[model samples]
Target: MYTDALRAEWTKLRTSPGALWSVVALAVAIAGLSALAVAPVTCPCATDTTKLTLTGVQLGQAVAAVVAVMLLGGEYGTRMITVTLAALPSRTSMLAAKATLVGGLVAVAGTVGVGGAWVAGQAALGDELGAGAVWRPLVGSVLYLVLIALFGLGVAAITRNSAAAVGVVLGLLYVAPLVTAMVQDDDWQERLQRFGPADAGLAVQATINLDDLAISPWRGLGVLALWTLSALLLGGVLLHRRDA
Candidate 1:
């Protein structure tokens, strides 16, 4: 039954024009922005200039989140969710299948986005970084996109409204950066940057100024992962209890 449910959702995603377009748009937006950010500046003093150049994850994440939210919310908007639940009968399996599909889709798209971003970043630097330094940002950026997709899935599950889901995901992604800017105290600003998902997650790409960083790069990405997982769990619980 679960297997069939998974197959069903996979079929749905594969046939959907929106799903295909979303993946394509996500790759282009993330990779293009990353390239633009990295192309003009060479962080000569930084050993891990790869990370600095690939800083477009800050903006690309919002695009991925929007895609993820639309995946589920589109069904709700079209009144297909009720039919989906009818076919599966178990809301748990339905949601699980959706999440698994969303994760897999994001993982594939993320690889493309991250790889493209890395090449752009490297070319922009006009210097070949050590393999070890280069791969971290490349890999971390992929993980970042996956987490953003998961975060969007969670938000959609919670809201079941496309407009609301988009709003919530965008707000979560963009608002923190703005609020961090508004803080009057330097210390608080730094703290917010260290703790905030965007600032913390981007830390994984940092290859320079380690001592001056509020949070280590990999650890910052971990913080974003934690946020993603927490939201998913909350959405899962709500999904289990909801009437559908």
Candidate 2:
């Protein structure tokens, strides 16, 4: 039954006109923009190298979010969710199927995009970065993309409106960093950085100057995981309790 539901969701995604473009865009945006961001740097720019690779992620995540939001939010908007629920009967199972598909697609896109960014960054640089140091960041980057998509899915489940969910997701993801940046206290700023999804999740990309960072790499990712899990659990509860 679960396998059948998964197949159905995949069919819907493949048939969606703009869905292909969004996945492509997610990859292109990450790799393309990261290359551009890191193009003019030299060897000593190690920290900058890792940081700039994230330009793609910052932009690509928005595309990823839209892909997830449209899965359920778009259905809600068109009242197609009723048809879906009637067909499936178990909202939890349906959500699990969709979530699995979203994570799988995002993981593939992220791997390609991160690989592209790694090549582009190396080509644009004056020298090679240590492969040993970069591998963790690369792996972490792909996982980060998957988490971001799931985060968007949870928000979409809660909002149940594509327009509103997209707006809220983009606003929080983009604006929260700015709000964190505008703070006057360095200590407080660092504290907030440890909690901000964008900041902490991206911390896993750090290869140099680890001691100076607000949070350690793995722990930062754990923080984002907490945020993602909370969103999913809350969304699941709402999906179970609320009227379709």
Candidate 3:
């Protein structure tokens, strides 16, 4: 049942009218902003230039969220979800299939876009960086993108509205951290930094000051994984209960 659903979802996603274009948009958004950030940097300085170039992840994630939202949300919009539900029967299988496909596709596109940014970062430095230095940021950024995509898929499953899902995803990504920043209490700030998805998740890019970071790099990624899993579970439960 799961394999069949996976195949069916793959076929549907591949034939979606906007699928190819959306993937292209994601890559371009990341690569374009990253290249722009890399262009002006005078590297080999006493700062984390890798993180600076990775600023594109901030803007590029919006596109990733939209692509994922549109995957299931488009079905809902067209009332094609009814057909999908009927064909699959098990909602869990259906959602899992979609999530797996979305993760795979996003990972590839993210790597291409991030690879360009990394190369630009290398050239800017006028010296080659060890794999140790480059691997963390590069791998973390790609994983971050994948989680963003899955997070969008989960939210879309719950909301079932493309615009509303997109709005909610973007709000949590961009606004939660903004609201956290307004809190003046140091302890509260640290707590928020550890919890907010964007705040905690982006910590994976930090290489310069590991000890001084509010949350360690891997722990921050764990915080994001928690957020992503919660959304997926809630969406899955609601899906199992609600009528399609």
Candidate 4:
């Protein structure tokens, strides 16, 4: 049953023109922008260099999240969600299937985006790309995009409106950092970086300065994962409890 549902979800995604174009746009934008961002500078620490090179992930994630949110949000806008729920007859199972499909596709596309970014950064920045310390940043970047997509899915499930869902997801992912920048004290800024979702999550891509890093690489990724999973669980609860 799960496999059948998965196939059905896949069919829906492929038939949607937005899905393919969004994936292509995401891959190109991330790779191209990251290469440009790191082209001019070299860092003493490899981690810093890697971080600069992967900066595009910070932007690309929002795009992936938007795409993910649209998967469900579009359905709701057109009142197709009711048809979907009726056809599947198990709302929870249908949502699970949708989430799995969206997550898997986003991960694959994100891999391309991040991989292209890493390679382009290496070529454009040379030593600035950070030698052997590349893998974590590369893998972490892909995971970051995937997580953003999942986060979006959860937001869309709860909100059920394309515009509002997109707004909520983007606000959660982007606004916190902007607000954190307004903090006056150095201590407060560092504390926020250590705890904030975006700052803490990006720590996974750090390949150079471990001692100075605000959080451990694994822990940083875990923080983002925690945020993503919590949102998903919350969305699932709302999805099961609310009307289609």
Q: Over the stretch 1-244, how does candidate 2's per-residue lDDT look in tens digits?
A: 6887898898999998798788988899899998988877666644556656666888888888889889889999999999888888788888889899999999999899988888887787645554336777988888988988888899899999989888877876889889999999999999999999888888888887889999998898888888888878888889989988
State the lDDT of candidate 4 residue by residue for 1-244, as single tens digits. 6666777778889998878799778887788788888777655543467777777787788888888888889899999888888777677777788788877877887888788887877786776566546778788888888888888888888888889988887776789878878989978988887777788888888876687877888788888888888878988899888888
- The regions of model 3 sitting more than 4 angstroms off are 128-132
Q: Give a tens-digit lDDT track for model 3, residues 31-104.
A: 78877876776645666777877778888788888989999999999999999999999999999998998999
Candidate 1 off by > 4 Å: 42-48, 128-132
- Considering summed lDDT, which 10 consecutive residues are worst modelled in model 3? 124-133
Clashes of each: 3, 1, 0, 1
Cα lDDT of all candidates, in order? Answer: 0.78, 0.85, 0.86, 0.81
Estimate the Cα RMSD of every predicted model relative to the unseen true structure. 2.2, 1.5, 1.6, 2.0
Q: Which pairs, if any, clash in model 2?
A: 30-56
My TM-score estimates for the predictions, one after another, are 0.90, 0.95, 0.95, 0.92
Cα misplacement distance, residue 60 of candidate 2 (Å): 0.9
Worst-scoring 10-residue span by lDDT in model 2: 125-134
lDDT of 1 by residue, 1-244 (tens): 7788899998998888877888887777768887887666745654566665566666677777877887788888998888898898877687778778877777787778777887786676665543346667778888888887888888898888989988887776788779898999999988998878777887777766678888887888888888888878888888778877
**What overall lDDT, based on C-alpha atoms, would model 2 receive against the true structure?**
0.85
